[model samples]
Target: MQLEQILRERKEDKDILLMTHIVLGYPSFEANREIIRQMVENGVDCIEMQIPFSEPMADGPVILKANQDSLAAGTTVEQCLEFGAEMAATYDIPFLFMTYYNIIFKYGEEQFFARAKAAGIKGFIVPDVPPEMGTTFLKEAEKTDIAPILIYAPTSTPERMTHLDSIAQGFIYCVARRGVTGKKSEFGEGFNDYLALCRKSTRLPIAVGFGIQDKDDIKALTGRADIAVIGSQTIRLVDEHGPDAVGPFIAGLR
Candidate 1:
């Protein structure tokens, strides 16, 4: 409930909240530090830090390349945990670790949960771990007070949403389209209906992710979704323009 309460309280003023994603060591930890400082300074509600998995299956080309490069550069789970702790303690916003389930499995679920809790991480978004396969993962998360965030795709049945809602905490990540992240998502009648199903199925705040780009996109989500997540675009901004470009880009989103 810590994360849920934070969002509810923060949402009292803003029509919609912003959440950003970063691969921990993509440019460099130094660049990560500067980017996060700017993000928090500019009023980002929360941030999800991806721990760079070799096979980030749900990600599009941009993020997939970041993960591969970070791993090739020898980024380790310990470094990510340390960085997470630093960010959480230094910034007021919530931080979540978004990675593949294999990372957790290899690190040992109990230890990962314990370390993440100690690091002050508020949630986990392991994209590939469905509830059926995540029984132990979810259990450890609950015991450690870490929200186990679950994803809902457009194809998910009403039954699937209900099942996911029963287990998810913090919020439900509603993938804006049928595919992976990066490509622009067109919001149409079908999209609205999909968001409606997401809202109806989960008491948790609905955060719409994949391909949410600028202010218009954020405006589009304002009433329909509680949080609008920005992922690959930010990474692209950092890559093309450098980490310093993140602040203005994020500021312009609202």
Candidate 2:
């Protein structure tokens, strides 16, 4: 099934489907493969694999360090694709790739899309690419049945949000804060208002990310979103306790 269908079927009245992110080459290719396997076994509905880049402008300190470590260990984009294809062959979950525009440009858009489609990738999240580009990559992605997910921050104006809603497919990533990706404070008083605004603008699935750490936050976010994306927290868990801790961490969220 598609990512959207899986999310809809898994979602409960107060339960949001969990979508987790991890750097694909973090530490090493083998480690990354094991991490993906563990996350799937831990009940992650969708997996966002971040390909390591020399300059990850949108990433925060934690992710940047992880990327650096992965690159230093000799993990490349090709390895990430091979690993993803291996996982896709066995798992039925959606595999989405998150990367900067430069990587796609360097690899050639058509080449990237063709390889990703052959490898069973389901979607793309290019945060650095704006709608104005409107390149052939977008068209090819649609043709290949790969959805391009978009991100919108909390500080986005209504006009921008509406525009994003129109172009976004599969899901809209609602950044919990205005900063780069990392952990942060709890959802404040205006959280619901922000969610309400997104709901008003989009019919696609809405998933919240950034600073979502524990069960309390998940419980507080119940009914506010269709998916709860926990990235930094899951990465932290993998870093501190290996992939074995992912299952219990997910259980805590539920």
Model 1, span 107-173: residue lDDT tens: 9999999999999999999999999988999899889989999999999999999999999999999
Whole-model alpha-carbon lDDT for candidate 2? 0.82
| CA-lDDT, candidates in order | 0.94, 0.82
All candidates: CA RMSD (Å): 0.7, 1.6
Model 2 spans with C-alpha error above 4 angstroms: 12-14
Error of 1 at 35 (Å): 0.6
lDDT of 2 by residue, 84-181 (tens): 78877878788899988888888888888889999998889888888769567678777777888888787888899899888777899988887787
Q: After superposition, how far is residue 190 of candidate 2 from its true place, in Å?
A: 1.7
Question: What's each prediction's TM-score?
Answer: 0.99, 0.94
Q: Which ten residues in a row have the lowest lDDT in candidate 1?
A: 1-10
